[model samples]
Target: MRLATVADMPRIGTLMRVSGAELFPRFYTERQAASAAIYLTEPDITLIKDGTYFVYEAGGEIVACGGWSKRNKLYTGSGSQQDDGRLLDPATEPARVRAMFVRADWTRRGLAKAILDACVKAAREEGFRSLSLMATLPGVPLYHAFGFQETRQTMVPLPDGVQLEGVEMTYELSQ
Candidate 1:
């Protein structure tokens, strides 16, 4: 697999949007789904284009993506609240990994793990102390395998008063 760039966002977004179950919760909620879809569909959900975004591409297809948002204001403090890497210290928090996604077809193939490792390594290389992610309902297990643990749960308000349940997770580096 090869790493992707800003150009791969649309394809990556489409991948998750297509795998509705893996993305939009099985329980249908228009507001929740719409809000989640809108944010994740963007290339910078993890603020990659404006910072560090990583994608896993195989056979010329973008199968997975994750980003290490360096700036706190990327998505109105999203990069700050969920990214524990930043909580450690500003100087040590250049990159906060977020919005990790692997195609449904690519599941159990180690793409998620690979993409996660890449994001962590990128953050550490940039001198970040830890990496953070807001684990989606289906993404918790993957993050756990990479030494991330739940730090908090955040509820994202949607248009119809529904909420998207997300767990804020963090992976601290040995440094």
Candidate 2:
């Protein structure tokens, strides 16, 4: 895996859509999946620009993407007006693990774990004591296995009047 660039946005967006469509049905209702599909926005340029985003390529195809951030925005790329790009106080706030997705054909192969491990290591090196993420229903198991504790569950309202259930999870980095 390597850092993603703006040029990789199209492939990353495609991977997210394909992965979401295949995986969300395992936990979400059909209507919810369809409506919430709008939530699968393109890669956030800020992540790429910040050099925090990464893509895993195999057989010359981008198959997985994810990242961590020191920014206050917990999530973005859904075309929402919510992200403010404020810097996180790493002294107090946990680093944000954002936008994790794997290709439909690439699930359960340790790609997510690899990405998370990279993010955790990077965050720790950056002096963060903890990491946090808003995980979709399909991602809970992976995060849970990676030592993340769910702090809360909430619904994210999509633009199409549908809501996606998500969990807020955190992990404390071992010193």
Candidate 3:
């Protein structure tokens, strides 16, 4: 398992398991829009620029990945990169865990946890005290197991006007 650079974005973009348009409204219960967030392609650019991505693998195959954004000097809003609610304190680095998924063949293994551990370690090393993520329904328990608490429910408002229901979660990485 290792970290992925934006060079790995195309591959990671392909590996991400999407729930499909109907599934979004089915599982978390969201309203429809012109497009869907079923895949990472919708917001690929922002996901790349906003954060660094980590990839998990076995035998050189990319299995899972998630992105962590370090707080930047500027704040645009919740919908873009460099948006940290406009805080300038470096230690207050806010992060986002985006596009995390394990290959279908790799499920039930501890690989997800391992990848998650790496993300947390990197966040801490980057001087961040906390990290946030939008948990997919099936991934909620996994995040909780790693000490992430539910903060609120959210929606990733796609540029195409589609919004996917997500659980807003926060993880405190320090004492």
- Which tens-of-lDDT digit does each residue in 1-175 have in candidate 3? 6656667766775666342332333455444422443433232444455455667767777766665656442111235554443433436556666556666567668777877787788778877788877775657878888889999987756555666566878889873
Which candidate number maximizes TM-score?
2
- The global C-alpha lDDT for each of the candidates, from Candidate 1 onward, is 0.63, 0.86, 0.61
Q: Which regions in candidate 3 have their CA more than 4 angstroms from the true location?
A: 17-51, 72-78, 81-88
Please provide TM-scores, in order, for all candidate models, with all chains considered together.
0.76, 0.93, 0.72
Better of 1 and 3 by lDDT: 1
Cα lDDT for residue 80, model 3?
55
RMSD of each: 4.3, 1.7, 4.4
Task: List candidate 1 stretches off by more than 4 Å.
Answer: 20-22, 27-31, 45-51, 73-94, 159-161
Error of 3 at 42 (Å): 5.5
TM-score of 1: 0.76
Global lDDT of model 1: 0.63
Give residue 72's error in model 2 in angstroms. 1.3
